[model samples]
Target: MDWSKSKSIFIIVFLILDIFLYSLYLNRHTEAQKVEVLGEKTIEARLKDDNITYTTLPNIELAPYISGSVKHFTNEEMQAFNNHEVLIENETKIIVTLDQPVPITDVEDPASYVDFLQTYIIDGTSYGLWEIDKTNQSATFFQRINNRTIYYNNHGMVKVYWNANNEIYQYEQTLLLDLVEFEEKEELWSPIQVIQVLYSRGLLKPDSQITLVKLGYSTLVQFTQTQVFVPTWEIRVINSSGQQEEYFVNAVEGKVIDVQFDQSKVEEDEE
Candidate 1:
């Protein structure tokens, strides 16, 4: 054997192997550190962008079924769930804050004075004041009540008056100066008013007919028509007695339109 040739070959092979191992180690270390840095940056960016100000932790508890399903969920589904959770938490916080005590101010004759408040104040709730505007010769009320800062004409009905806020500890008469004259009562039936009248008169019963005698006719029919914008139907009801009667009633408004008796039918039934 040639000792010099063998020794040279062994040295060359060992050097080659050492270089390969060193390269592998360096590559592995670089990859591991790169992943760690990327992960940390991603977390920091998320926290900054979230913009959550509350210090309290969310009270959401994962249901067993949902947790199990999430284990196999896709990336999109997971992202969507996280977004929903964030939205829900934000909404809850907003609702809680809304329930806190908010200062409310009633401006006299809000329709006229709202402009003044909007021009001067930056924040707070301003309500319309109901007052007789002598200049306009009509009952005017202000409308902008919920933190309105802009001034505009014909924004809402005249706030002529408001009852006391029952919830508040102190009671105050919310009044505004009357710059305009009060107009004569105009006959207009709002939806709520119409419903209230029907309910109060016991005319809104379903699947039944109410017969208004002459008394019912005068009280229910024309008055309801003039008040509400709907027509009334006149229905004639015959009792078990041998007497026929006719009645006029408003079907929709639940008011008695007219009532008359079928005298012939009543006689026949009696026979």
Candidate 2:
């Protein structure tokens, strides 16, 4: 009923609202500034203090998560290849034995090995050479999507077994089907962030040398008919004792993945 009294009350209410909004803005600004500064320096300081050394981090900025199902090989599809005895297991894998062993003319040249695979193997172009186990006279290849390796997916890989003659006698293959990327891409965590994650979790020992750093995808979830993949960083480190280990970090989520543990769990679930 009193006009002046009502005006004064409204002014007081607006003043309180302004103060509340400004406080929220200040809090958010401070947090962001801290992140910007800490993200650049804190990780480096921690890594140095822990006596960890790494190769240069990549300049990569953005990446996307992807998902796909494992291919189910039908007889019709499996019958396409020649000169090899192809066997389909559970309609999901191709196990092949060459009627006669193919000589790998150059054991030292990795490109030569890839050539052999592309010539005699199905979906060879879809795989990237992973490792050559000289002790076992074998080589392993991992399936690739978007030109990036899918690290150690059981359902999507090739294992080539060679005789002492350095000839490929047999190889098994699997593939991912209907690969699709998510519409929304993510800003990946830089290599520094990934390393810091491992160090903070006590995964990286002091005086460790990171010998290899690569960008790839690892299994995110395994469903009965499909599997989801996410961008990950594969770091190979050698400790002070000269022992080597590999670690995977989820690029988007910044979580370290115990690859061996996850692989074992997957196998157990399948069984």
Candidate 3:
């Protein structure tokens, strides 16, 4: 009966609905912007607020993904080693117990042990000393690719145990073979960005001291005998109570990495 009036009413109703929907969208968008801005706080400011202290961050800019298979010992290679009981596990690992424990003049110095490693380990120079656990009387060396460490990859590591006399008695070694770097290098996240990730995730506690920050590679994908590694940042922090912790961040993906190793498996392997 009143077609023109009814059409106008319908238009007004639709117009009001459109405005209401647009308002909602605008509010959500604004809120998101605010969240992002707040989240992107300056690294220094955030650290200062938490009483977390750090020295200069490393200036690593880019890195490439790398892949390699575990080194399989050949009969010739096995024979080349001297003066110890050697066990080859599936041709992928070398376990050596010294014929007589070799005394390290100064366990704290690399020079005291570097010669022993060179004389016994395959490609010993490729490994860098990672840690010396005095409580356990052990030293760990991790393999390096392109002068950067392959952080704690079982496929490429050396662990030596010392006897009560501070002499190295036995060692377990595994190496990666034919490591190939991808030609496509990716720009890595800034060190601060990675640290920020840890802070936001509550991994970095207040009143902690950031003692060390370094670039390395952690396992991104592991196969039966091979692994793919991505650039990662390993940060060491000392809490107020004097306890130390290590955390990792994926430099390429800008996310935290779980640094916990399968301790049970390691113990089982040692047995």
Best by lDDT: 3
Give the winner by TM-score. Answer: 3
> In candidate 1, what residue range of length 10 has the lowest lDDT sum?
62-71
TM-score of 1: 0.14
lDDT of 2 at 160: 90
> Which tens-of-lDDT digit does each residue in 7-38 have in candidate 1?
56545544553563365455544422322232
Worst 10 residues of 2 by lDDT: 262-271
Cα lDDT of model 3 by residue, 210-269, tens digit: 999999888766656556777888899999999989877767656566744311011110
- In order, candidate lDDTs are 0.26, 0.74, 0.76
Reference-based TM-score of each model: 0.14, 0.77, 0.78
What is the Cα root-mean-square deviation between model 2 and the actual structure?
A: 15.0
How far off is residue 74 in model 2, in Å? 2.0
Model 3 alpha-carbon miss at residue 126, Å:
0.6
> By descending lDDT, how would the candidates be arranged?
3, 2, 1
